[model samples]
Target: MTGASAGIGAAYAECLAARGFDLVLAARRTDRLEALAETLRNKFGVAVRAATADLADADQLEAFAAEIGADDTVTLLVNNAGTSTLAPVADTSVAAAQAMTDLNIRALVRLTMAVLPGMKDRDRGAIVNIGSVLGFRSLPVSTIYSATKAYVMLFTRGLIDELAGTNVSVQLVAPAATATDLWDISGVPLSALDPAIVMTVEAMVDAALAGLDAGETITMPSVEEADRLIADFDASTLALLGASQKSAPASRYLNVTA
Candidate 1:
């Protein structure tokens, strides 16, 4: 489990430990990681180890990947480490925006890539990536963050496609703005957002697991009306199916030909 230090990641750790899975928790925060490990060990009798490393860093990431790669018992991978920035595109600092991309998109992809070879070889594994409802809906302040999550959703779906005959299953958790430290991390005061929009961490993980068990590729916890969302995504995908990429520019581009 990556991002096991706080928010959804920490909740996932607790939930999985209660179900009898040992954990190698990785995150940038050593103190919080160990603290959570201790709590899980005491409360659930699960073996927990803290892997302190900034997964956004290439060297640190490769080392952590080596650790997971070396462990044959790693049957499940939960990619929950991510950062979101709350600024309009023009106002968002370049550095902060880049950092978010590094963590949410780059690091997540690298970690998944690292685990997949072993999972494919083992023929039995599961992966759950924490996404957001914003992946489906546009939020002006969360544009870049949502784009990264959209990548996760599409990436997981593609993995599902390629791994159809394999035993490894991939699930994407698209929770609405959840009750987590993410609000603060994203520069939003928790009180400023609609309380109803927030979901508890435990409920999010539980719903995600239910979807995983049911073999769902996408799980949106707060959306009780699941069929509508599925239809929406399907319609969007169908619209794109007719898009042309290999052909030359259509007549619509003739006026701008230079």
Candidate 2:
């Protein structure tokens, strides 16, 4: 796990440790990572290594990627490290926005690339990407964050398509307002949101794991009818894609050629 220091990432670490998976926890905070590692080791009797690295830094990211590439024991990768700027595009700083993009998209892509070849060789592995419910809709304030998550969702789905028939599985976990520090980072207090919509981090991770076990490509924890919603969206998307392959432009665009 990339952001194994806190919040949902930390929760995932605890859950995975409880399940007897030895862990390699990575984060910028060496102190926190080491503390979590110690706790997991003592509690679960599983090997835990703390890797301190800022994934937004290319040098650090590649260093970690190289380590993962060389280590054949890695069977699962949870791409959970991400940042968000929950403000209007006009007000958000360019540097902060770029950092968010670097961590959320670029680093994720690079890490996935680093692990895939080896996973294919092993014929058994899984990649779980942390996405958000906002990925499916247009939401105010969370515009860029949602777009990045949308990329995550589409990216994982595309990987699922290519990895089919292999033992490798790619899963996108889209949690809906989970109880985490993300709201604090986004400048929204947890109390500001409706209590009914917020789910505990444990619940979210449990549902995501269940979805992974059930062979689902996309997992939306809060949605009661997720399967129906996914089926409907996939049908519509397939129709649109099929229609776009026509030989000629549609009548709607005939007179409006640019």
Candidate 3:
């Protein structure tokens, strides 16, 4: 589990540990990763180890990848290391944008690439990408972060399609704004969000696992009725198909040349 030191990634690590899965926790923070490993080993009687790498650094991640890529013991991959940028694009620092993009998109994709060939050879594995509700909706302040997550969602779905005849399961877990370090980084007040609607970390994870068990590629824990979201997706797909027709513009756009 990459990014297993904190937040939703930490929750996934814990859940998998409790389920008696051996783990290799990867994150930039060595101390936090080691501490989490010790706890998982003590509590769940699962073998746990820590691999610390700043995934934003190419050299570090590549070295880490060489080991993780070939290891047959790792049957599950949770590519969940991510950061956030919460500012208008005009004034957003290049560092912040690059950091988020590097961790969220580049790290996730590279790690997946590293482990996928092995999994495909074994014909058995699972990948759960931690996405966000913001992946579906557009928000002004979190444009880059949201866009990266949107990529994850689509990428996971595409993988699912590609691996349909195989035992390699790919899932996308979309959680609404849960209480995590992310908000603290963004300086967004928890009070500003609807508290009643927010799901606990456990509930979110449990629901995602349920989806995994049920062979659902997409999981939305906070959503009660499935059709609601399906309808929205269908409408968007319909719009996409309509756009492909490339018809003439409406009467309003017609040139009324004098």
TM-score of each: 0.93, 0.96, 0.91
TM-score for candidate 2: 0.96
lDDT of 1 by residue, 148-253 (tens): 8888888887888899988999988889878888888889877798887788898888999888889888889888988686888788887887666547788877
Scored by CA lDDT, what does every candidate get? 0.87, 0.91, 0.86
Give the lDDT ranking, best first.
2, 1, 3
Global lDDT of model 1: 0.87
State in Å the error of residue 237, model 1. Answer: 2.3
Candidate 2 regions off by >4 Å? Answer: 256-258
Query: lDDT tens string, model 3, 49-120?
Result: 999899999898888788899798879999888888777787678988888888888888888898999999
Question: How far off is residue 215 in model 1, in Å?
Answer: 1.7
- How many clashes in each candidate? 0, 0, 0
- Per-residue lDDT of candidate 2, residues 1-258 (tens digit): 899999999999999999999999988999999999999999999999999999999999999999997889999999999888788888889987898888999889988998999999999899999888887774788888888888988898899999999999999999989888878887677889999989998899999998988988899988899999999999998999999998998989788868
Q: Please list the residue runs of candidate 3 whose C-alpha ends up more than 4 Å from where it truly belongs after superposition.
A: 245-258
Worst 10 residues of 3 by lDDT: 183-192
